[model samples]
Target: MIEILKPTELPLARETGALVAGILQTLKARSVVGTNLLDIDRQAQAMIAEAGALSCYVDYAPSFGRGPFGHYICTSVNDAVLHGLPFDYELADGDLLSLDLAVSLGGIVADSAISFVVGDSPQPESVALIDATERALRAAIAAAGPGVHIGDLSHAIGKVLNAAGYEVNTEFGGHGVGSTMHQDPHVSNIGRPGRGYRLRPGLLLALEPWVMADTAKLVTDADGWTLRSATGCRTSHSEHTIAITDDGAEIMTLPKG
Candidate 1:
């Protein structure tokens, strides 16, 4: 469902968004070389519990995934892009890692994701892939406002990714998030403007723009969760929870510090 949150709830949404951002930032900072993916998940669990927030992923059993996620956060490495279930794997220098998180605080939910290099030795392709997703996310946010069509945001994001020489996968993209983690009004990475739902004030959307280094095709890992590039090429993903306003859009998932 497409939900336009009440003004009173915007503050709660902001709080949830900030919490999600802070957790991802903390995880990223501590994810140095030799850090295990399972350790990262444990840290996320502790932080969520300390913050008095509920994890949207732990009990999540969507059609695309097998059973409950049983994890607090998603840890995508290198070629892994979406629904990356945390496992027992140590991060190495120059590894591209993406952390996606969603949490509920004050009865409101917010979601976001970030991609960064694990260590000092960053690959040129990895840096470029991360940069493209970040740029696309920013463009999508800038295009969101009351009366603007969802397609406009998609177009803006698509232009950036396509120009960067990467293809987008529409199977999974951004979606509405408020009372629940995933809602209606699916926002694809690419589309034609002037189509789809019109943006409205108080509408919260998790605008994510992810791209693979080469092909758009995805292959699900044996874990039945992590989505990797068909050609095993590296990938990157960037996302933020934004609230549409009368004037424009306000990004709620930015790290305060």
Candidate 2:
């Protein structure tokens, strides 16, 4: 379902987006060497509850994942990428971690993700992978605006990843998001320009650009939710929920001071 926010509904969306961004920023800052994934989830729950918000993940059960995700946030480390279910593992120095979060506040939902290296140790490959995804996300956002095709955003993102020498995986990509966590108008990471759905004011889209270092193939972990690189290569993912407006695309998930 494609949900277009009326002018009156936009304020709530902005609030939800701010909350999502703030939680992600808080989680990213708290994640470090020896940090337990479960602890991170707990932190997210606390923040959501304190803000009178609802978690889009806690009871989320989709066909591709195990029923009732039963978590507050997605903690993807190293090889893990999408739908990363929080586990009992503790992060180590230099571990590549991606925090994906979504929350509903005032009846509107917002989603976002960030990839970073944990602790003081920084691995060159990990940094490169994260940087590439961030760059691709930026490119995709830049390509978004009124009348822009979904494929235009995809092409922009794909070009950045391809140029960086990483394989693009389209199995799971961005999508429309609003009142619910996930919605229609699937946005692939790679495609031809001037195709697919056309952008319009008040439309909200979550544009995520993710890539694997070596291959485009993915393998589901035993947990049935975590998606990892088939070759065990490091991966990275970046995402943001954007609202199309008359001026251009407004990034609703940016952190607020």
Candidate 3:
């Protein structure tokens, strides 16, 4: 379902977005060599609870995933990209990691994701992949505005990824978010401009652009949730929850001080 937030709902959304961003920033800072994935999830849970917020992932069970995600955050490392279920694994230096988070505060939901390298390895390919996704995410956000179509955002994102020599995957992309986690208006990573749903004030969209290094194909992990690159190449994902306003698109998921 597509949800348009009223002016009053936007404040709650901003709060939720700030919480998601703050948690991600905190996790990014703490995720280093020897950091356990489960520990990261534990930290996220504590932060959410302390803020009196709710996790959108803990009990999330969709058709593509195992029942009850049972995790506070998604910790996708190296080849893993989307729906990364946290498990017993310690991060190693130079491991490409992606943290995707969502939370509900004051009855509104916000979602965001970030990709980074763990520790000091600084692999060039990994950095490039992460940079591409971040650039694509920015391009998509720039394209978002009143009267803009969803495809415009997708096209803007796809161009950046394609130019960076990465293949785009449409299987899973961004979507609408509001009082609930996932909503309608599937925002693909690639599409034609001037098509799909038109943007309007008060609309909230989670625009994500993710790409695998070599191929667009994906393989599901044995856990039935983690999505990995078919070629086992490194991957990256960047996302933000944006709210449409009269001036333009307001990015809600920015790290809070």
Candidate 4:
């Protein structure tokens, strides 16, 4: 469903978005060498409980994933990209880790993700992978505004990723997110500008730009959740929930501090 939140509801969205950002930031800080992915999930659960917010992932059972994810956050490590279900594996230095989070507060939902090196040691490829995704995400956001077509954002995102020498996986990009975590008007990572759905004020979207280091193909792990690079190449994902306004797009998921 394409959900356009009312102006009054936008404030609630900001609250939820900030919460998501804070939790991801906290988890990122705690993620170090030898840190277990499951431990990160536990920390997320605690924070969500403290905020009195609802985790959109814990009970989420999408068609493509195993029923009831039963996790508070997604922990994608190294080659893993999307739908990364937290497990017992410990993070190693220089490991590329991505955290995706979604939550609801005051009946509004927001989603966001961040990718970073797990420890002090950082590989050239890993740094490049994360940089590409972050740059692409910024490009997409800068192109977002009322009356702009969804394709414009896609085109903006694709330009940066392609320039950075990374291929985007369109199977999963961005989408409408408001009352629920995922909604309609699927936003692709590559498309012709001035095409697709036109943006309108009050519309909320989760704009994510993700790319694999060397290949566009993806392989699902035996866990039936984590999506890894088909060639086992490093990958990165950056995302933020934005609201369309009369003037431009307002990023609601920025960190509080």
Which one wins on lDDT?
A: 1
In model 4, the runs with Cα more than 4 Å from the true position are none
TM-score, each model?
Answer: 0.99, 0.98, 0.99, 0.98
lDDT per residue (tens digit) for residues 1-257 in model 1: 88889998988888898899999999999999999999999999999999999999999999989859999999999999999999999999999999999999988999999999998999999999999999999999989999999999999999999999988789999999988999988999999999999999999999999999989999998888999999999999999999998899999999997
Clashing pairs in 1: none
Q: Candidate 3: minimum summed lDDT over ten consecutive residues — where?
A: 7-16
How far off is model 1, as Cα RMSD? 0.6
User: Each candidate: what lDDT?
Assistant: 0.95, 0.92, 0.94, 0.92
Candidate 1: clashing residue pairs, number: 0
Kindly report which residue pairs in candidate 2 clash with one another.
none
Task: Give one digit per residue, the lDDT tens place, for model 3 in 1-257.
Answer: 88888898888888889889999999999998999999999999999999999999999999989869999899999999999999999999999999999999988999999999998888999999999999999999998999999999999999999999988988999999988999999999999999999998999999999999999999999999999999999999999999999878999999876
RMSD of 2: 0.8
What tens digits encode model 2's per-residue C-alpha lDDT throughout 175-239? 99888989989999999999999998999999899988899999999888999999998999899
User: What 10-residue stretch in candidate 2 is worst by lDDT?
Assistant: 3-12
Provide the clashing-pair count of each candidate structure. 0, 0, 0, 0
Q: Supply candidate 4's per-residue lDDT for 205.
A: 93
